[model samples]
Target: MAKWKLYWVESDGYEDCFVVAKNSRSARSVEANMNGFDISDATAIRVMDIPDIFEEKADKKFRDWSKIHAPQQANNPDLHEWPWYADKWLLEELGAQFRVIDNEEQILLRDIVYAKKPTGEWYTYSIGARAIYERNKDLPQYDNYDNEPRIDISKQLYTAMGLALTQCHEIEFLFSNSFVFAVSEKQKKKYKTFNDFFKGWEKKTLGGLFSAMQEAFDIDPEVKMALDLFLDMRNTLVHGITTTERYDINTDWGQKELLAFLDLFLSLCDPIKDIATSCFEVSIEIANTYLLKESDENIPIKSSNELLSLFINCFKLKSMN
Candidate 1:
């Protein structure tokens, strides 16, 4: 199967998607997509493959996030729902909208096939990636992440998880997890059990996403205690177990710990990407067997329940064939 080592998609800005999608001008349309400001009013569409390095930064973060849990919708096609999935920007807002006044026809964003208009003068840029119906037998490789702390965490996550006793202390409570009894003690009273304290890490991040005192950190007893608690919190959040939070923090605040969590998650997935991807395929087969109709049209491509699927899909990314 063909791969997008480097690519972009664009629209012809037409109301009739099928036709205009096949016929927008390349140079001008691409210019509009790149530079938000317009030099000319002529309708345009394009995806200029700037130097491969240009997309590296965004792709690096995206692939890392995808490996961790970002389901591939258009981006993470394999994963299920994320908290952000409900946002309108990434979904159907597939590409930036612009007025296609020239001779554009179709509106679907898929591929950039160069097709001329019926009037003989204008040609439009097509938008979207065209994939083969069959799954790609080969693996996908993208830009690599070069962050020091994140990369180190990724390397450490799996080994640390396995050797839990030394690598990480599974403290029952975050508030009482740390040796700093004075500070965490007052916090502990609010949580009856250590698990309850853990429940609040995601919720509590919002409370201190910017504060000085940390809830989790590298090799810190307090951080370990806090993380142990958070793992249970994540479990409860997923399994529908009853939970009350005295401390509520954002699960992801884009902080060092969050980056570390991402690194560790991705590192752990590195071993499972292939197995996970295959298992995901098997699950889809099981799903298809129970579906109302098995045809492509009837198959649901995106769903609110695919978060688990997405997580599994990440297991397949950057894996051994």
Candidate 2:
């Protein structure tokens, strides 16, 4: 038989209340679960109570917030007095728009996953809710940050994004696209400040995009030669060049080339964040384009593949026209 436990951690201390669910998860699996939940230190176990796990950055913030505010609240200490668990849970309406997840009670996004599957063939998911909670005022500031895996290069990109709000120097982006990105070294001379770096991002992006594509795909000499020619003529900015000395910041062929690379690279990267972002975009487009007021009553299916298909079909149709 498997055992499960649900305990709540607070400034006042721990309590055995909600039974979240505890099973014989393997050490590796348990560790992964802990990482995902942002639970660095584990103690009591159970099933029913939502995991109080939180990002390291946000963890201390929540603890302090709890101490000052509702120290007696039996709910998650991080959310102490915020009605976040109650009012603003995410839910998809008929038109794929979002509403409160479960009535007016507080709920975690993960807890309602299985139940939130789309009513049709395809579905969409968003980590944005997580991003939103991390930034929203209702939740304790620290409840939103996860900092342990700062060494993971891939996730480091996101960690940098989270830390961006705090002005913490974890990762610095040379460029930011829908899902594609390139990070710069701390000692590098490419950018002077956060604002300066991002301001000139689109210009630097094409070089990175071209490089990413050339690496991912084995392009023929003819295609590669042609691409190089066009890139130089239209978008010939160098990626490694990180100086404000005299760089052009125009929406030239470089931006277009880089955007192309981003489109292709995202396909390979499988960035759930971008996919989820696009899913919401598609949902809103569908609602505004086809369905209107009745959109809220309809649950449409919009998957990454479907979005790609729509993109291709629209291109084909436009070419035909």
Candidate 3:
């Protein structure tokens, strides 16, 4: 048996991909064949040996489940027919998107490689730490007219700012869904009515959602404080950035201010991210609790009302920390 080795392959103008092959030559060949690039022009760096039993059982279980439940059409899947599966799919998709955005932000902050083009525009690229070092190692250092090194600080800050805002938006969406699940439980317990006050709640601002959540539950003070700080930073980036003349992207002083703002923004992201993570955890737990039977057998799916009790209970238990 040929032992598979992990390799990181990079080709010009193509997204880097990982391949499992017996050797570096095989890895390059695999990438070239997969991406329609010439093997001669591809660079393959051996990463490590592929673990034989990494998630083997889980992988087989998922494969079996997928074979049973896989949608027939790419876009026409009847996931909605199974509410539990639909919610599970949606949550997984959201988590994947969040991870991608978070990773892009980290790459921009750490592994970015950029240069000024002939057209006076900046070109920035990143392909993780190793690829970044490989590509940047041979580049000649250039300096500005004042003997200072030429650096695209503004572009980095601008990109980082955009990513930070995007992450905030994702967090808000997750928080909003969590609030709905929690509030739905409250309504069912108290009014015994299916009336949802938070319909079209996504249209509301994050501040409004925060207020509503506070009024609906005994939210942890630390969570509230973290969310308040996040909201303040998010609002400044969204609303105050254009009107505020102090933080200009065109000058060194303005760029410094922008960097400072971004630093603080990123610092606040950890706590907010923790809260979002808690929301996801509770939502998944609620789904598992109500959607699956104890014997791992499919039962008659209950109405959303029945599920709401556990949703709010899980939310309160997880969010209070």
> Global lDDT of each model?
0.32, 0.32, 0.54
Candidate 1 lDDT over 56-130, as tens digits, reads 443544566676674553365443221111122332233323222335432222332333354543344422112
Model 3 Cα lDDT, one tens digit per residue, 7-35: 55667633455455668787778767767
Model 1 alpha-carbon drift over 4 Å, by segment: 1-36, 39-176, 183-321
| TM-score of candidate 3 versus the correct structure, residues matched by position | 0.41
Report the lDDT tens digits of candidate 2 across residue range 14-118: 211121234312322343353443333433332132223422323455556666785664246445321111112112101112333323222223211111223
- Worst lDDT 10-window in candidate 2: 86-95
Index of the highest-TM-score prediction: 3
TM-score of 2: 0.17
Error of 1 at 178 (Å): 2.5
Each model's TM-score, in the order given? 0.20, 0.17, 0.41
Which candidate's lDDT is highest? 3
Better of 1 and 3 by TM-score: 3
Between prediction 1 and prediction 3, the one with superior lDDT is 3
